[model samples]
Target: MKVYISADMEGVTGLVDAEDVQPPGRDYERGRGMMTEDVNAATRGAFAAGAAAVLVNDAHGPMRNLLPDLLDPRALLIKGRPKPMGMIEGLDSSYDAVLCVGFHARAGVLGVLSHSFMGHEIEDIWLDDQVTGEIGLFEATASAYGVPVVLLTGDDTACAEAVAWNSSIRTVPVKYAKDRFAAQLVPVAEARSAIEAGAREALRSLPSAVGAGARTLSVRWQSASVVSHLTAIPGVARRDDRTVTVTADMPQLYRLFNLFLRVATAVTSNPPYC
Candidate 1:
């Protein structure tokens, strides 16, 4: 079986702030190593579960956070930006399962470094009027391709979020949140072991397929200017001064969400979580 892993930084082990996930800082540099180690753990678990191939996507801010040299040689890595599917890039029907590593809660939540796709720029997002975040969006999109999200690793809140979204998926929590920027973290070695074990068990007995279909996506931006810019795209409609809604099926809706991020990037210079 082929396994796909999407790696993000915010929910990585021992990370609790922007200084740890953002670039050009000593902490961020160290965090990258930690992120790579976590991905390696998950990859190792996938292989142990009898997976023949594994693909790991660097799904964080710049999408280049994972160190290629340090990554597990047995797994292929997808790095860099401008990807059509963003977090779920390279996901397709060929993969048997997906593993979301180091993901956090959505914006307005209390998970460590919590925010939606674009830090403070994206206030909220809804898929068919159900509040959604990166985790939910990725799972929904993956389902469209007939792939099951078997394993997820993150903080306790992130793990809980995953269970709430789909009860059957297995989760390993690396930390327990005390606040948005603070958490009681598990030791690095212990966290990785749990992640490895979780991945192994999750893949051992995969969940039944949960089908997908067309849905509407509504995004609320922190700035009206960002919303105004997005309306220029076809099928995007203004919902309010700071919100816009678009309807499309899996991959199309997923692509349009990325386009909205591009527009938001062009219009706003506000720092994330501001």
Candidate 2:
């Protein structure tokens, strides 16, 4: 069995500020180490459960959060910025399953550093009218390729949010979110162990179906012009003042998502647009 891990940063232990998630800052370095530890736990678990291989995609900002030097030598790391698939670069139908690491609750969720893609620009995201965080949307896309999301690790709010989609999915809550920047944390060692257990269980008892479906991403922005700006993309629809939705025929929503939203982020953050 091959496993794919999508690693993000907001829900990692001790990550309580925006500065922690950004590059060139002191906390970012520290946070990346924490992120790597979490991924390593999952990878170790997959191995313990008899996984043949694993691919880890650095799903956090800049897509370079995890240091290969600290990563498990057994698994491959897909890193860097501007990749075709942002968070999920190497996903395909062949992978047996996927795991989400250090993921946060959706926008407006009560949790540490909680927000959707842009935080400031995106208010919410929906697939098939169900409000979803990055986890849910990624789960849907992964399912489209016949891969199941077997494991998730994050804050309590994120775990709670994930349980809404699938009760059977295993979760490791590294922190209990008290607010956007504050959470009650489990120690690094404890969190890592829980992650390993969740990963082992998810892979060992793999679900029969991962809920595959059409790949469509609907983004709710903070303003109308952001919607107008994104309309330049072919086949994109401006649903209203605050939303723009895109549909893809393939399971590569992550790449298309990066293209459109990176542009949206630039446009909306500009003075005249917001």
Candidate 3:
């Protein structure tokens, strides 16, 4: 079986602030090591569960947080940004399963480092009228490719979010959120153990198939200017002063969302979460 992993930094064990996940911060380097170790734990579990090959995509900001030199040699890594599929880059129908490592909860929720795709720029998102964060969006896209999300790792709220999206999917909580930038962490060793075990067990009883279909994706941004800029794109309509809606299938919908981010980035000068 083939396993795909999408690793994000904010939800990794021991990380509780932007300084921990964003670069140039005093602890960002240490956070990179922590992120790499978490991915390694998942990678080892995938192999133990009889995976023939594993591909990992660095899915955090900049998409370069994982240290390649320290990564598990058995799995291939996809690092860098501007990927067409973003977090789920390199994922496809051929993969048997997908694992989301170190993911935080969606914007407006109480979870460590909680924010949507573009940090605070995105106020909220809805997929076919269902409110969703990155977890739900990625899960939906993966399902479109016939790949089930077998396991997810993050804080307690993030884990719960995943279960809400798909109860059958297993989750390992590395920390308990006390606030958006603070959490009670699980010891590194203990968290890794749980993650490895969860991955092994999740893959053992794979679902027969994951249902997928075309849907509408709506994004609410923090700035009216961002929404105004996005409406310039074809097929994207203004939902309101600060919201835009688009209709598309998986992968395409996913790509369009990223394109919207690019446009927003070009026009907005405010930092994330400001």
Candidate with best lDDT = 3
lDDT of each: 0.90, 0.81, 0.92
Tell me the spans in candidate 3 whose CA falls farther than 4 Å from its real position.
none
Q: Given candidate 3, what's the lDDT at residue 153?
A: 98
Query: For model 2, how does the per-residue alpha-carbon lDDT over 133-171 read when each residue is reduced to its tens digit?
Result: 787877777777778888888899998888898776788
lDDT of 3 by residue, 12-110 (tens): 999998888888889999999999999999999999999999999999989999999999999999999889889999999999999899998999999
TM-scores for every candidate against the unseen true structure: 0.98, 0.93, 0.98
How many clashes (backbone atoms < 3 Å, residues ≥3 apart in a chain or on different chains) does model 3 have?
A: 0
C-alpha lDDT of candidate 3 relative to the true structure: 0.92
Per-residue error at 194 for model 1, in Å? 0.5
TM-score of 1: 0.98
lDDT of 1: 0.90
How displaced is residue 175 in candidate 3, in Å? Answer: 0.5
Cα shift from native, residue 129, model 2 (Å): 1.3
